[model samples]
Target: MATLRGSLGEANLGRLVVLREAAGLVTDLVGSEQPVFAWLVHALGSPIVMGGQAQRTLYVADADLVPVGEVPEVRLRMIIEAQNETDFDAALAEAAAIIDVKQIDDKELASLLEKAAEQAFLAHSLALVATPVALREMGFRSMAGSEEALQFKRAHAGVELRIDATADWLANWRLTGISHSARHAQYSEKLLPNEVARGKVFLAVLQIWREAFGNAGMPECLELAVLYERHQASMNRIHVRRPVLTVDPKVFRAILRWMQEQEHKLLDPQGDVTLAFSDGLLRLATGNVAYGCAAWGDWVDDCVVVRQDLLALSGPLARARQIRIEQAADHLGINGLVLHRSPHSIVP
Candidate 1:
């Protein structure tokens, strides 16, 4: 970003002056206040950037996207267009950038950028889906999907390790999506939210490029995540207890049916029906009770009981309210222990 800031932006004038000074082309600025000359020249001249639809924007190369039209020829033509300018070196820089962008003329450049952008989008979306599952398991919640987060639910042995191709692809796609998303963040207030937004978007483009190009710069998302967690230890150190949900998996099926049938009526009492994963079962913790959501541990476990922990939040009284915890439990139908309140107590 700092690398491509000068050439096509408002600072291009100052950047040019600095470059001239560096080349010894300007003699009067013997007392210049800044030494942003050499870096400015190099930044502008780097082949990684292009002027965007907006003035301050710097469009960079996308490795995942192939040019819609003939890119190599377009690259050459880009050189020709900028070659006739007074500053031939600068023209060469701009030309190289155009080549890198795979956009200089008609249908070709746009096509490539778009194709690459779509690929980037897929990668980002995949990453987004995978991350929340991981985070939810670890008793964590993010404001939004972030590429840098290593924070995960406390780990235990009871969880199923089944990885779906969709989930995996979704995770990677999400990483790309976030990177691409960041580039568009500035276009709106709610969209970008913060610097992290743009970083994620651009980072996806970088990731896609890396798949083809040799590894270049890494994304800042990773670094930012590490900093945010303040992790006192390595990922291996986090530990959590596992649950015994599949002792009888039949109840799990009935619970699933109940939930699907009474979707609106059941879940209204529960606040968003949040879950915490503990390897085998997911815990729905409220003020008093923690309902363990049971998924069938295996194909043979037809006797599914959703982790056996709904007694505390159920029964006729619990379900009486239009929006009560019992109605939510009816959907989960998991069989588990409950910590109940006392009815008769004699206090001194």
Candidate 2:
């Protein structure tokens, strides 16, 4: 990624230069008395009505010059990095989308991103994660890394993600969450070339995130870094609390299948499997741990189907179950009997 130092305003230009230089990015005059590199703040750092590819979108910020000739009052700060120049170019375009946002630190920028993501997901019923460039355009400064997923919850959100509260908010907002936390951390580590063993350690800790969140385990440094990297790549290196809905039936089931394929290290040693169900009505609930969190989905049909699959399961446990599975309609409510083994059968 390329870091573009944009300085503006008559108030401060020296601080901007100093911060950029401190960041180890600088350019010199190629042979002219005036340096092309410092033109942003050199002549007189003032908020110019400058424009970019998008008309009237980019406005240089008000700035002040410091004693050390650095621009201290940098109204806007940003970080840019990309896998390649093409990625960087694509990112710049994304940044152009909201170039009008005023100066904001990474945290506020992250909140905006989470809100925007929540809105987008709600509007589309999809899980939409904000890209680094998207965050930058929203006035979020990048700290480090490129693939970090920013984390934060809506300030308006009454509940945190991963709990039933968060899930309920997503439903209320008509949004879907793409739970890439564990999966992304795992995928990111596998992409590393050297230190294969070390990479495994990274995933190992990430695998325990649920346990960590539940107050049962602690994540290691590699896991922390992986999450940190995600945050760094996010708006201002922050986490966005984006409300997301479940993936499509196919994808949701696949996610569960992938989880099931993994060893049961993430779950409590006592965690067991059973039928799951949900409606607008919350009658009986099985905590996430009880259902193994794998093979369980949130869609009413999927849950009812899975519930039936569990009830019909051919085992000693199946005969000894107590949860109610309704297959027929009654005066009370519509009930589903079959707990589906996989999500596909519920739809087709």
Candidate 3:
């Protein structure tokens, strides 16, 4: 996470580039033969050539280097405390006399080094497009949290959300007395947690939907229907022309905030509550209504029964119902409840 800064002379620029390029080539050549050296080049940082025949050792410099008497001063050395004389000799031999320190101006050297550092940073940023997970594992924590990473996530966010929502919809479909197929079940299982790795909101939404309605009436069903529609439109647009995939930062932030709010509401007692069993039916009371379903039957067997004064009381039912609905939509699952509230009507 440490930022690199330094200046290199114009005359030394060629030397630095040659050394870095040679180190890269050497790393590739001896990659299998010398895993440690390869790791030092890619994971740790470029190694510094030091010493002569008898005491030749490749020192992995942890910070920006400035040419000293003969070798650069090592600052905050890494824990990989082994010296590979053979690899060091090979790297030194490959990057031989690209430039002489005595001929380079000090100010130009500093400027060149600073430019080189910037170039290296750009290369690292580009590399993230290919090896994000690997780079992240190699102590590049700041890089993973960079705006570049956020942009990458945003690019695929829409597709990811759609896939997840579709899976949940299919799972909920089975609960509604629709014939269940193995394919539906498999897809639901596979796609359910796709976004959980990215953020907690995805998992939170899924859990709230599952526990509250068991795949029957979803409060957020309308929102998910809309999301799926938007997803289809996006896909269709891709067939005719390349559509830009960019998520507004403000939208992303708003989503996270909403999810956090839903999480808090779902955890409250009044938001969703299981009532005492009546006859052979299981009753769940939330918001301003009481819902009843057979203990063992398809979710389609569910019914919303009127609770005469349910809304009159100043209780958690309304808030709970709203939370359940929002969470259901947020998770992209099927919700059985009709969004409209009609106190005296029975919805079956």
Candidate 4:
């Protein structure tokens, strides 16, 4: 591990300096050991008029070693007269880039550095907010249940959409599960005329948020309304709608049991088993062979013929259940899918 430390400052900005003695300790051990360890700290202090100071640290060690609980070897102190949030962002980006160029080589090390920077930036930004914001104030509230659900409310907001994790919620809405489609006409005939509108709005809201944040975890709910407003125009253009299929609870449960029984045969082949609902039938297919059945009172009618030679189930049965739950959630307008096995329920 080679550590580098330095600082820069401006007249109105507070002075910036590096703890050279500390930095030298880590830099000296760079190529001499099998597992290298480096620690660096950077502090940025602004003038009284610009609000106080913020400190951030970066630490990196070999993946296999237990890290030492000691003070960092290198420390860089910075003071800048940041006029606004943009200035602070620019300064942080520059500092992160400098660290990236100097000591980042391992992928994990780089990720740690990035995470530290993001945390510091978010902390500073949140600190600047004069009034604290709550999720309820932003028209978002969690429902009272074991499963997480979000209720969005706003005047003239079209409809208050309550997104749930379980298939039972869809029953409450009188809607069925559907598959993804590239064309709108494919699933239009199956859904009610009013449902199409509601589903469109629901899906559009989800799509906007998904596109903006991705799987990077939840963002601060305070800014959600602004994000929705910004993306509203574009969301209206989403034409492809997800298909919905109605299934009896007993039938879905039976399918789950059958899947559990054939878990080894379904997963052993290493290819994804795609379960789709269409034409009043639930179909599970992987590779060449396909299976279909219609659910009627806890049992499937017209079960697919199985060729013993072609069936080879492997892997954990829980995985297949998870996939089915996830698919159901996706088609049923549920977000943040979490399948809990102990209670055998899906939570969001």
lDDT of each: 0.31, 0.29, 0.30, 0.34
Please write out the lDDT profile of model 2 over residues 28-87, one tens digit for every residue. Answer: 211223212221222223222322222111212222233343333433232111123445
TM-score of each: 0.19, 0.18, 0.18, 0.24
Candidate 1's residue-wise lDDT over 46-115, tens digit each? Answer: 2332333211112221211222232254554454355334355765687679787864675676686688
Q: Across residues 220-270, which tens digit of lDDT does each residue of candidate 3 receive?
A: 322333333344467688884321112222332333344334443443323
How does candidate 1 fare on TM-score? 0.19
The candidate scoring highest on lDDT is: 4
For 33-62, candidate 4 gives per-residue lDDT tens digits of 432333232223432221243433222222
- Looking at candidate 2, what is the lDDT of residue 244? 19
lDDT value, residue 149 of candidate 4: 32
Better of 1 and 2 by TM-score: 1
- Sort order, lDDT high to low: 4, 1, 3, 2
- lDDT for 234 in candidate 3 is 70
How close to the true structure is residue 18 of candidate 1, measured as C-alpha lDDT? Answer: 12
Clashes of each: 48, 50, 20, 10
Off by over 4 Å in 3: 1-96, 128-348
TM-score of 4: 0.24
